[model samples]
Target: MLDSLSLDEFGLWAWWIIAAVLGILELIVPGIFFIWLAAAAAVVALVAMAVDIPLTLQVALFAVLSVIAVWTSRRYFARHEVPSDHPLLNQRARTYVGRNYTLELAIRNGRGKIRIGDTLWLVEGPDLPAGATVHVTGVDDDVLKVEAVH
Candidate 1:
């Protein structure tokens, strides 16, 4: 079976098979990276079928096309970054910013606790009584920075 296949036929088949494998890998381990390489391989396969190009030239074409595709994609993504509406979706603590909460514990020495959405969060701010209202100004890791809501 191996002897029956000519060099040109083998080269064309190899390019197509590699492209298919890369495409499948992209689906399994999705990072939007391998798909570009697969596209480059497909282009080389088409070129190989049209004209009898040398193995070195075919490999070089694949490499050059892959680099061009990857560079173009990076530039596109950098220029057209889609801002998420819920910027604080993963950072639950940051979402508390601008919201008002009453201190459940007295803020002595710039530390206190407040109840927000069934969770008690440690807060940092000026000293205040237990029942005083505070405004969430920002978040620092697990702690929420607050100011007294006069």
Candidate 2:
């Protein structure tokens, strides 16, 4: 069936197919990329369909388009940040700040552990025995900084 189309038609179809594949990949492995490549491929396909161009030029055009699309989108997104309901969604440790929890282990030598759900988080604070209540002050790296409740 593909043999029925001439070389130019085949190239156009190929570019459109590449564009579709890149678009699908953008959905699967999303990182605000791949979509630009897909757009570039679609643009190349459109250009090829309108005018006869060498394969080298088609590829070069796609490359330039992809770069420009990605750069422009990145700059636009950087200037206009997206608002999220949970800003600390990715920073779970920081979310613990201002929360109170009972120390699971004694803060001997300024180190101890606190249990949150099924995870035991390492905490740093003054000496406190197990079962002492502490308030989360901040997060330093992976360790949660805490202080005695009273």
Candidate 3:
């Protein structure tokens, strides 16, 4: 069965198979990545079927089409970003910004702790006695940078 078709016919079939494989991989993967490659392969297969191009030209065509497709997709996605309802969903410390809380421990040497809900978060601020009110200014790593609420 393999010996019947010419080399050009075999190359055309190969490109079609490559396109199908890439399409299947796109479904298995997470993002919109492999689909573009699959499209490129399909286009190359169609071109090869219509014209008697050599293997080198077919390969070059696939490369050019893939680059253009991927680049255009990236640019489109960058321009149209999906907005989220919860902006600070995973940012625990950033949620505390602009919020005020009473310090449970006195800040000595610009280091102290504060109890927010069930968590005791480390804070860095000016030296103040226990029970001093502090405002969360920003977050620096795991530590919350606070200032005296005055």
Candidate 4:
């Protein structure tokens, strides 16, 4: 069936179909990467329709455009990182930093547990007794590093 179509017609259809497939893949995967490739393919489709370029040149143009699109996206994202008022919003333990809490469990050998907002957090700090006031200083994985408030 494809033998009936000329090179330009085939190139146009091929690029457009590839573009559509890439676009759908981008939606399914949600990586924000394939959309650029789809755009490049669509641009090539337009070029293929308007020009009678050789197949090799068309492939080269598509590759170049895709690379440029990906590079530009990377650079743009690098310069414009997503900024938020709460950088630690997703880090539940980090959010406790600088907050004072009473130790529910005594620190034996620099480890203890504290109750904060109905959650028990494992903490590391200088040895202290239960009921001692401690301030969260940093977070290490699921554990919080704390210091005596006094």
Clashes of each: 0, 0, 0, 0
Cα lDDT tens digits, model 3, 1-150, are 877865466667988998999999999999999999999999999998999889989999999999999999999989998798998888999999999998988999999999999899999999998899999999998899999988
Higher-TM-score candidate of 2 and 4:
2
- TM-score of candidate 4 against the unseen true structure: 0.72
lDDT for residue 30 in candidate 1, whole number 0-100: 52
TM-score per candidate: 0.72, 0.82, 0.64, 0.72
Q: Please give the distance, in angstroms, between residue 13's alpha carbon in candidate 1 and its true position after superposition.
A: 2.3
The CA lDDT of each predicted structure is 0.92, 0.94, 0.92, 0.92
Candidate RMSDs in order: 3.8, 2.9, 4.5, 3.9
User: Tens digit of lDDT per residue, candidate 4, span 56-135?
Assistant: 89889999999999999999999999798888787989888889999999999999999988889999999999999999
Off by over 4 Å in 1: 1-9, 100-105, 114-120, 130-133, 140-142
Q: Candidate 4, residue 57: CA error in Å?
A: 2.2
Q: What is the alpha-carbon lDDT of model 1 when measured against the actual structure? A: 0.92
- Could you give candidate 1's per-residue lDDT for residues 13-128 as a string of tens digits? 99999899999999999579999999999999999899988998999999999999999998998999979898878898887799999999999999999998788899999999
lDDT of 2 by residue, 1-150 (tens): 866865356667989999999999999995889999999999999999999889889989999999999999999999999998989988999989999999999999999999999999999999999999999999999999999998
lDDT minimum window of 10 residues, candidate 2:
2-11
TM-score of 3: 0.64
